[model samples]
Target: MVTNGTYERGDLFDPNCGTRLILDRIGDKWTALAVLRLQHGPLRFTELRDGIGSVAPKVLTQTLRRLERDGLLTREVFAEVPPRVVYDLTPMGRSLIGPLTAVSDWAEEHINAITTAQGQYDAGS
Candidate 1:
């Protein structure tokens, strides 16, 4: 679906397209958590890790790198005794907060039903 070195209208629906790549990045649980945390304000690496609890340092590093590479967030390093680094969402990433919040709301509303269905399916199995 590339006409002039850009994806056309239906490129997102194509299986062998870049859309899946970007989706895989943002669709990740860790990525979602990181985005949610950064929505409030910029935070240091440790702050992000602590806020998004249970994530390993290495995994969080990978998620942050991917988000930075995708132009969703910016990473700034400060010259200090410990060389502090902070992460903040760019305009594009900020724009995603509304949609992500809607998804979060939907999940919160449906979680009970989803768990019930899962329990039923497990029992039936």
Candidate 2:
């Protein structure tokens, strides 16, 4: 028998399914920035931090680890005295760039509309 908790086919809205898990992983402020940075090929840990701008090192490390664990990025460590660590987007992460860009453009285009709608909502309330 099929379990109710299972996603089966073509069911992405299931709360505990892989799709939801991925959504939870990537739906964060830092994850978006991290993905954007990795879109320009791979970068060392320090470079990622700089590219993202002002994110604390600890937060950046945690974000990268979460993304890596979720298969959106690959973290590589070079064998050396201090060890060089780099992050690169996986195919999954690269696939997100175009979509994210469209989302960004949409937000830019609709800022006025959204603000107006919010104002209307507040006035109605």
Candidate 3:
């Protein structure tokens, strides 16, 4: 339920909860990178693609479309000789940055340990 624009938190543990869908969206690698790339400001398609490195054009387009559909970002098109489109984060999207940054920090801190564990597990298998 929502009251005056604030949502009553959903039970994420519930099997039928919509929160899991959101979790899936935010948990994607491309989503994370795209959000991080747009943190500074909006960018055109090519600019975002370049900033995100090797993601294929189709993959990035799909990711951006998903983000737009989820209301996490906005896509604007401008009419010109060649046309222009820009992607910018919404307020809700900007809110994700801090949490994502924390997760990123945790990953950076534990990556070596994680890789070591993976190597050990692979060797045992």
Each candidate: how many clashes? 0, 0, 0
The superposed Cα distance between candidate 3 and the true structure at residue 47, in angstroms, equals: 1.0
lDDT of each: 0.91, 0.85, 0.93
Per-residue lDDT of candidate 3, residues 1-125 (tens digit):
44587556778897666677789999999999999999999999999999999999999999999999989999999998699999999999999999999999999999999999999999999
Candidate closer to the true structure by lDDT (higher is better), 2 or 3: 3
User: Could you tell me which residue pairs clash in candidate 3?
Assistant: none
For 1-125, candidate 1 gives per-residue lDDT tens digits of 56778865566777887677778887899999999999999999999999999999999999999999989999999999889899999999998899889989999999999999999999999
lDDT of 1 at 19: 70
Error of 1 at 51 (Å): 0.6
Lowest-sum lDDT 10-residue window in model 1? 1-10
Which ranges in model 3 have alpha carbons more than 4 Å from their true place? 1-8
- Give one digit per residue, the lDDT tens place, for model 2 in 1-125: 13686645546776545666666666677898889888989999999999889999999999999888878899898999899887899999899888777877888999999999999999999
Candidate 3 or 1, higher lDDT: 3
Q: What clash count does candidate 3 reach?
A: 0
Instruction: State which candidate has the highest TM-score.
Output: 1
List residue ranges in candidate 2 displaced over 4 A.
1-14, 115-125
Give the Cα error of residue 45 in candidate 1, in Å.
0.6
Error of 1 at 46 (Å): 0.7
Q: How many backbone clashes does candidate 2 have?
A: 0
